[model samples]
Target: MASALSEATSFVPDEATVDRFYEISGGNPLLLRALLEDCAAAQDRETDVLDPCVGGLPGSALTHAVTTCLNRSGQLAVTVAEGLAVLGEAPDSALLARLCGLARFSAMQGLRVLRAAGVVTDLGFRHPVVRTVVLENMVPERRRELHRVAARLCYLEGAESSQIAPHLAAAARVDDPWGVGVLRDAAEEALVEDRDLLAIDYLELAHAFCVDPRQRADIRIRSAVVRQRNDPFAAQRAADELLGMLRAGQLTPAQSLATADVFSGCRRIDGVNEALAALRGPGDGAPDGPAGRAAAVIEYCPPWPGFAPGTRNPALEWEGRSAQRGEEGGTAAEELLRRTVLTDSTLATVGNAVRCLVYTGRPAAARHWVDVFVREAERRGADGWYAMFAGIRAELALMTGDLPAAERYAREGLERLPKQKLGTLAGGLVATQVLALTRMGEYEAGARLFEQPVPEDLFTSEHGLTYLCARGCYNLVTNRLSSALNDFLAIGRRVRDWGIDQPQWIPWRGEAAEALLRLGETTEAEQLLSEQLSLLPAGHERVRGVTLRLFSQTVEVRRRPALLVRAVALLQSAGDRLQLAQALGELAESYCWLGEDGRAWAALSRARGLAEECGAEHLREALLLHQGPIRSEGARADGSYEDQLARAVAQEVVSNQWDGGWRATLSNSEKRVAALAAGGHTNRDISSQLHITVSTVEQHLTRIYRKLRIRGRDQLPVDLQFCDGPTTSTPCRTLP
Candidate 1:
């Protein structure tokens, strides 16, 4: 049977044999023996080697290739082999020394034996495989010692820390001194991948093995950051452990600072504030040497839940006076700037500290730091962080009310986002666009974009409720009343569910109430508006003032003079231009409704001025549209004209069935003219009705067409389409 198998193999290797060769090479001793027997049998013949790729190379061939590379580099010597003796993977020179220093020479010698026997060989003549095999056999402590050594050597060789970290980590696991450093490098790489889970593992390893409390603190802080999103409370717990070390004098100030930052990042506002307080506690000995400067401002990283400038935080203040350090002129900004200056030129630290600068309302300082981050990101070919910083700058512009600049910056930032991050950040970009468009009075376009669905994940952020609320307001502005109401109701439920009755001056909530009022739901609208108004913080006087202005608009139609006067008076006190314009527009309509034409015109002119001041072209347009009701020549001066006008407005309202106020203005004669007009009738055709001459009919028709602003009678179709009710096409009957 052996003879038959040998003859069957012949001198040529077949495709079928490739798997057996790889398997034997992979660690099958029986398969290796069989393959060797076949190779010996075919040695004398001109063999057709079946090796087509790495997959096809035989065990013998791989052994020869690895040995040849090592031989050619003259790295098959005892010195090189001894260095790789204890590793299961590539070991830098330092790892070899550490193993030797630890009296683990026997483990290292095993690798040398494999090298000599050609059982293990160098990858790129570096003896990588030999080292890996030897190290695999060592105890965890010895392996960790070797890994610590290798990490240092790799760092000296300018190798990528992330690329070399795994091997070093094994060495560190065996009580290696350099484990902490290796873990730091690995955790950083994992963070870049957003693989916080892996990062936390490495950090814990560093914490357990690192002798230096400061180093342990550094790793623990990063681990806490990794855990923050998945389990915020746990992350805070981990950070608190580090803080305890600092308080016990077991950690340095720099380490304590890092731990405090992790707390802030997790939004553990109370914990961060408490840590800061302890850091600045009485006789908390100052940090020694260069770290002392950081000690003076250890409490200045700005506690979480930062306010936009000029905003009050009564609840936060009441919670604790000392913890309320995010108030105006807080040292957080200054200390952050100082640390930012101390940051190394590395992309990592520069990017890290600058992020705080932006968050602390020091964007200009951040701008300088961003320049450094941009250069490094470009060198690394990573656009993600660069684009994020650009977006931050755009937000700063928005806060300053530099709308044109904000738009430009936001657009440019969108262009810089990498494709991988597009889904995550796209919603914010779309929101920025919507804000710009709304500010520019492009309501229709904004409404269309707002209707686009947002990702469910985005709803978990701080801005989630605000984004949903904005969608409601956008719908309201574009006349999508039912949709607006639905969005408003949804927002109400979510906010109530979250127990968040007091959102900041988002304005969307107020706008939602206004929409309800516009839809003629006065009672419900008043209640909602009152709820929002009640929550308006003391510092947000502008918003509260605006809410009062909105209150004056209620019942303006029924009690025009009284409501109009209140609206105007509210505008006179601490007027926001946008609010003033809205009030004046309402006041003008009230005057017109009460037949006080002179007062109405004057009020309209005042509204136009404020609209111009506020750059609100849409409000200006609304005021112009309302002018039709007052100046319409078709509206007769006769007593019977009143009933006719009311009936016509009612029919127009019913026809549209969407706009109640519009229906109220449509007169009977107007509806008559509209039905005939929609029936494709001429002015003369409509003229014959109601016993009027064609000349008078023509004159009245001209007035009718102008009042509705139709180009001609044909375009002014009756909304109901027929005298009886709505018809699919023109009615077969003439106007009565």
Candidate 2:
């Protein structure tokens, strides 16, 4: 896997460029090679690869191969292959039969023929490149028809509705009642899978088909909830439309309350307040029901700003000194949970209940609720809900520093994810895996995850915070300080810009402060830590401990050794051994600076033990450095302790400089072009391979020559290997 990735990315110079390649190729090795070959062809001066032949064009060689293969296989095979391409790289034989409107035996025969022709792999197409070529060659109308057939087949096979959703979306128009019902089901399934964008798309499709006013209003409300993270304005528009329906008497009191529930889940605080006011109006026909009371509780005592309204704490306004207020709020929230469990244990209600408990700092209660929800979902055979609940469990485990548990839960959740190209649940599970591995100090394992193509939506507001945090930590551990700082700073900016200033939810400020401190900007680090400390609610002992440890690192070691000790105590209380080990190492250094040899040795010993136990290589190395003769009296006689520390810092800076310089020498794209050129691919061939203009390929070659300090292609070394094969490295053989 590493060799394949390195060959594909050899021309790419940086992490960002590698990420781009992954995004383009979707981590398929064959597709990556095809792109590289096209790039090589484009860069060749002698080859005249036409612009129209690039990418998945109709007359491209790859496309021609696919066309020839299908032509030889007969019409039934051609139809089956086209359906599979539209559905994606792979489709089950049964599902393909349904989509192709063929008998099961005939469909299997067609598949066998395609496989024998080397056009199909067991999983799907022989390569995604072939799939793309086939799909792009089809007429738009034909493609839409295939999608429609695929959607109906998936629905009939009892596949998860999310699997059917994109097909429906691609079909463009669904005016029939059965189509509308399918869309509605797909929307609900999308929501459970956390594919909010897909949910919104399905709901809109359903709305276009529906004639009933109340049903349309319901779809509009649901759309608002799904759109909140990516399109707040759209959510607000949906809210407005629902309000219009309410005033026009198109919705019943119960329906209005349900709409309010949706509004609350979407975090539209103003919408929730308005809905509650309508319910309280004289002769408004608002039923005094559980939904209405829930809305009233949310209106009266809103959650902390940026807290999703779906997870509104019934006890938030009552948790202070007023016992009576606490009881009323707590009772209301608990009653809602009870009713939801007994009467309507819908996925949405169970999810909201779990979030409420978690945000309220009640993990034990939250865990219990989650267990029940998972069991209920299983009983109902709701795989989507089961995956979502399991993901939440993984997140909770991560928060509590249970690395093994988090990994287990995340893996289990991922198993239930639908085989869709873009799924929010899959993104969350991948993020969870990244977080668990990185936090556990497994940097190499975490780095390998970048080999997989990250879904574009993973970078959107819905999952951005988690993605940034994990990436930042990975960068930090890998000694990419500047990159790490950028990621952390982005998190800070995102929170402020979004008006979601709930630090306790993500605690990005603390991570940023750590980065700032490492960069030697102590004043900025101090300010960030101060703000973070202030924002931390009382009783958040674990986060407070983590924040204080970072804070101590920003100040003079001699002046606040006590702060490190206090942080150690707090971390111990929080049961975060990994962090506690880091804190001990910092405390040991502080003690060493203060001329306390005995305390320093004791601290180092404990830290080393914990680091070894947790397999924290970075922390263990630091501990080893401190435990060396540098801490002895003999070292003091040889040189001042300050001088030794300065030398170590200088060494780190010099190492970083060398690494950064090499990384900046050539962009990843230049490297790819250079490898292809050196491997004897013509400029035109490189362009065709990479799907870029020939001029672009030439420009990349020029940049590569300048960066590598080479005068011309002949100057390239004999051993300058391209990833295609080891034997291809002799540039002399490719030269005229």
Candidate 3:
């Protein structure tokens, strides 16, 4: 059939175009030939009939073909074809019945007649071109009327709001009360599904038709709230429109409070405060209501710094209040926030309450709130709220060192984000995922996320802090020290400038100190750590545990052995196994340096076990190097200590050989240097042997010691003799 069509046109279509033709013609040879003849006839004098654009076939050819096909069927069939064309090629039998005001059986017969005539396929109009041709010939008013019918049909069929919205949008008289009401309902449904932009469109259409001033104001407010996630400029316009309504006294007191809530949630702090003040004015009497009390709580105790010009400075006030009221005041506020979470609170109120609970060191309660919100959102099918709550849970899990839970929550949250309309909420989920992967030692995966471009608007929101911190940590692990230092420092500067230096939220100072330490700036590292330590409240045990661990790393191992001990205890108490493993490893090294072999062995064993359990590969490798071989007297029966040591070295050799373990620990260059040094070669001799400078040899040896956790050349492992030997006379035996 394709060959006959090709012969008729004297030109062969590309594979894709041929496939498209087959799809449109439903493999009917006559239809295929007709389409080819049309293409051939429409070709310009110099144009190929099967050129990339299919020789620019005119719409008239399609119109003629569709008209001819429809003429072969009864009027009922023609009407069903038009209905399918109006619905754009996929109208079901029931929708056809609804559109044509016929019985379902009659609609099915009509479809069968059209199908037999080759004007319709199992899917709908045999081809999209056929539908376009039929619709193009439709009169303007008749097309609008058909669209209105289609919208009603979709609504009655329980189609998705996104699916029904476009039909209503295309109706000619969208201001009709029925259309407006449907639009409003569709908008609310879209919002619940997190189709915020879709919701905004429906609300705008409904607002245009709304006759009542209060209803119009309500639509404008709803549009602004949905627009807050995306389209900030549009949101601001809607907010301004609502503010105009407020000034004109068109909005009820409840509506005014709702507007203020929207403004505050969107970070329009000045507008929210203005509305709240108006509601609280002496003659207003609105201040005695529940809305007024909620507004008062926000005004009196803002959770974070406001992002508006001329807004009250809450940071200083919060600091003074913290000092005066202390933990008791925090507990009272937490209880109040908890009660709010249990009530019918807005998204803004719930989010602020969760943040306050976390900030007050009550994560268990925060988790409770998050779980409750997630259940409610799922029950209501509010995908946006579910994503937001899951993101919060991810961040909470990451803070408490629950890497698996953090990754799980982050992935689930990210999947819920609207593909085309991700905002700061999505950014927060990405940050949480990256942080979790990095902490779990999946640096390559985390680095891939770092390479992806972040959204421009994300930096303007609070989630920006999470992104910067995650990026900094990724850089630190990938050995990009300068970049890591700059990012962490930028976070500090931003926190100070914004007057929202909540260390528990970002912990930028502790991160920057680690970067500084890696850069070999010991003095600056100590200063940063000391500053962070002083700022942290003495009772925030989890953060304090982290700060103490960083502090222990800054000073000499022997000078702060006790600090490492304290850090290990705190981390264990907090159940941060990853950091606890790190602290225990450091403590083992200190114990070895202090000549406490038994204590060193115990600490190293515990560290190795924890590292293995947590999948901390780097820590496991380091601990393996620090741990000396275990002695077993039964191996030789009459064994002296030397025989036991020899047995241990043999066991180590077998283990290393099995896993390629020794090679995994040292780089090729370090291996070469260690082998030569173990063969009793001087640094200069090894440098000469390896054709490198003496300083390079020394550097390699230094790295080998660090990798193997040995103090000097004399303590080099017997396995070094097996790495790349020079047939040295020095025996591969235990040191006496």
Relative to the true structure, how large is the alpha-carbon lDDT of every model? 0.50, 0.62, 0.66
- Candidate 3 regions off by >4 Å? 1-140, 143-201, 207-220, 224-310, 313-345, 420-422, 554-559, 628-736
Per residue, candidate 2 scores C-alpha lDDT tens digits across 1-736 of: 3345456443424555455545444454444565456655665646543221344554544455556667777988887888788878445677777777889898888888877766676648755667876677688999999888777767767777667778878998774457777788887776565566677788998888788887887777767656543443355467768877877778766666666665544334444445544555454323356544653433322332222333333423333311223334334445566766422224444565566455445566667878887786567555555676887888777665567678778888777655544344466677787888876677778888656676553443335566788788888878788888889888766655444455555688788878777888777776777666545544444576688788777655654454565566656655567787888788778877788765666666777887776655666777898887335554334434334333433442343211123235666776667667755678998898878999999898788777655566653322132222122321111101
Off by over 4 Å in 2: 1-209, 217-368, 454-462, 608-625, 629-736
Query: Which ranking of candidates, highest TM-score first?
Result: 3, 2, 1
Candidate 3 clashes between residue pairs 3 or more apart in a chain or in different chains: none
Arrange candidates by lDDT, descending.
3, 2, 1
Which candidate gets the maximum TM-score versus the true structure? 3
Residue 287 of candidate 3: its Cα lDDT? 50
Q: How does residue 195 of candidate 3 score in lDDT?
A: 67
Residue 591 in candidate 1, Cα distance off native in Å: 6.7
Q: Candidate 3 on 1-736: residue-level lDDT in tens?
A: 4575567655665677777776666665556666765666657555554532241244545456666777767788877777887777555677677787789899889888877766677748766667776676678777888888888777777776566667877674573456777788888777656666677778888888788887888778777777645454455557667878888888877677777766665444445655655565454534566544553445423434342223343433553465334365456556666566322235665666676566556678778888888887777555666777888888777655567788889989877766655565677678889988887788888877667666674665567667888888888988999988888887777666555566654577788888888999876776666556545543444565677677767655565555565566556655667777877777777777777655566666778888777656666887888875422123223324333333433443343321124577777777778877865689989888889999999899888888765577765543254434453432211111
- Please say which candidate is ahead in TM-score: 1 or 2: 2
lDDT winner between 1 and 3, please give it.
3
Model 1 misplacement above 4 A? 1-149, 152-182, 185-418, 421-429, 439-453, 496-500, 503-509, 555-736
Best by lDDT: 3
TM-score of each: 0.44, 0.48, 0.56
